[model samples]
Target: MSKILIVEDEDAIRRVLKKVLSEENEKFVIDEAADGVDAVAKIKINNYDLVICDIKMPKKDGIEVLNFIKKFNQEINVIMISGHGDLKTAVEAMRTGAFDYIEKPPDLNNLLTSVRGALKAKVVKSGIKKNKSSTKKGKYEIVGESKKISDLKDLIVKIAPTNAKVLILGPNGSGKELVARQIHLNSLRSDGPFIEVNCAAIPSELIESELFGHLKGSFTSAHKDRTGKFEAANNGTLFLDEIGDMSLSAQSKVLRAIQENKIQKVGSEKDIYVDTRVIAATNKNVKKLIESNIFREDLYHRISVIELNVPKLDDRKEDIPDLISFFINLISAQYDKKNITINEKAIKKLSSFDWPGNVRELRNVVERLLILTESDQITDKDIVKFSGK
Candidate 1:
């Protein structure tokens, strides 16, 4: 059922509108608000598919309400209503992002048709939201039962709901990116975009434009206006991987964006405000960088409000057995091969080695064993040949 809110100060018109909307379809669950203030309060508490707001009302007007909806809930369709047929106000309403405009005494047929059309749009938005939620499930799984892994999972659950800036710390190939992604998956902005930028991968000269964007023809190589990661991640999560590798100049700009929630394009002075939840990961020792005057101390403090350290595979050896089995099934499915069994001795031998490269290295070794082994099962001999002990 789609919920609709009717914002009108007049009780009689409100009742008639409700009657007309109720007669349209049984799926329409309607609510009435006597004024704009009441409408906004209801909007804050409940999710409405469409709002029928009066252009002129007490305490607040339709334009004010429309702007508020655009700011917070862009998905909701709004239909502006008024007794006085003012073309200017109707045009203003449409320009301000109203779905449609209907002058009162609303033609029953016209109103019904408009309402149905607006409701169709609502259905489409809901379907997109549903598909996004489905995609988010099982997208990033932190596989392990060790105390270290469990503690990290607990911390993620506690902090994901809030818009806290997270700093993930770990060695190279220690699954820091995985931890950052998991945090994004569980966050309030899960339905929004997840923008990832690899600081170390991009050249220092182009990193500024890569992050803050630039206007076309503003620079020598500029051909098209580009939207940066921050704008791309507006109302979503931005994962800055290998953040310690970001240039000091870029770090200062990033610090400003974090402080003000606004960023300027590389070629433009106009500030663009973005509601991006930043989750930065770094394998490099940022404190040492700070002491060396390469990384800004203030920027470091800004991004590390919630620090999470991923445990190295050597430190969490209890998880090796589970990791091996996970990779076996995962790799087997990917390669269209039936998963083979690994004997106890093989497991023991694999777990005994010091994995300097962490979980990432273990996954690679498991896949190598699956592909290189001749028998139906991975045995102690396979481990002796493939496990670089």
Candidate 2:
């Protein structure tokens, strides 16, 4: 979740911006300030991910507020709101470290774009910091020996060496990401980066700009030339998750890119060639989506060069013991605890239930057992207490 601050003296503009931004993303927690002084007082108290400030206010101006935030917490991004005559001051504020500035009667698209970009930048920075302290973990393993899983492993080894556009079908939390990572690691492009995009998470209006790069002046808030995922994942594997939810407009452009091995930026006519391998995944049935006219048939055929269906946990219940053992050790180490052994009766109890949420939910239950259970060994009573029953 992202916390945002809107600092504008005008009640009408502040209320409108707050309403629109709240509607844009439900995860946003928004706060409003009537003046720069009030904004500074709140900034000192709450840790905001982004701030939208007005330049000309009755009290302290936007530049002062930006300076205060930069001095207080340089990581918090600020987007200045400038009037027609305040463009020069806005530019100065940018030089001082504002993320971007919007003119009065702000373009809805530009404001939203700037806000999204700022939040995304903060998240990337935080992730990088976390990764720096993390241990060098080994490759992601599909932790099951069921016949279905074994067959999937054999198929992955055969297809990974080739640059085939593979489509993976599975229910949510059935390890679709794990499968994609395994393929990328075994593929010829293992030396390159593995980029993953959740199609359902990005809004339809910004999908094009997110995939294909945009020029500095392409949109009202395109402050600088940006590299999109296609360019970022060049000579690597681009994993598009939840592809069935992508808008048809973006789907056509993606189809063009796959067909020609080239993609034009959002506002450019010239094409940029890329040697990218695309792997797509979706939980929905594409054939049904096509019949409903929600998904493009040509795009579906193009991406589904080799379709791999991952079985849900219910179908592979035979592997529950191995999966339980794997998660016990994996999650226990994260909490700095010794590996807690599970009794045979507890394992049997876990295996008997139907897991609609699949491996993801099971892992959560294991973690809960590790933390909440009193005994070193996980027994039937432990399973009953914290195994998500």
Highest TM-score scorer = 1
- lDDT by residue (212-248, candidate 1, tens digit) is 9999987899999999999999878899999999998
TM-score list, all predictions: 0.66, 0.65
Which stretch of 10 consecutive residues in model 1 shows the poorest summed lDDT? 128-137
lDDT (0 to 1) per candidate? 0.82, 0.84
List, residue by residue over 1-389, the lDDT tens digit for candidate 2.
89999999999999989989989998899999999999999999999999999999978989999999989987788888988788568656765667667778886765775677678657744554322123121558887878999888877765564455789999998999998888887655778889999999999988888898899999998999898888889878999999999999999999988755678898899888776779999999999999999999989867876788999999999999999999988888888877578999999999998999999988888889899989789999988878768
Best by lDDT: 2
The Cα error of candidate 1 at residue 370, in Å, is 0.9
RMSD to the hidden true structure, all candidates: 12.6, 20.0
Prediction 2 global C-alpha lDDT: 0.84
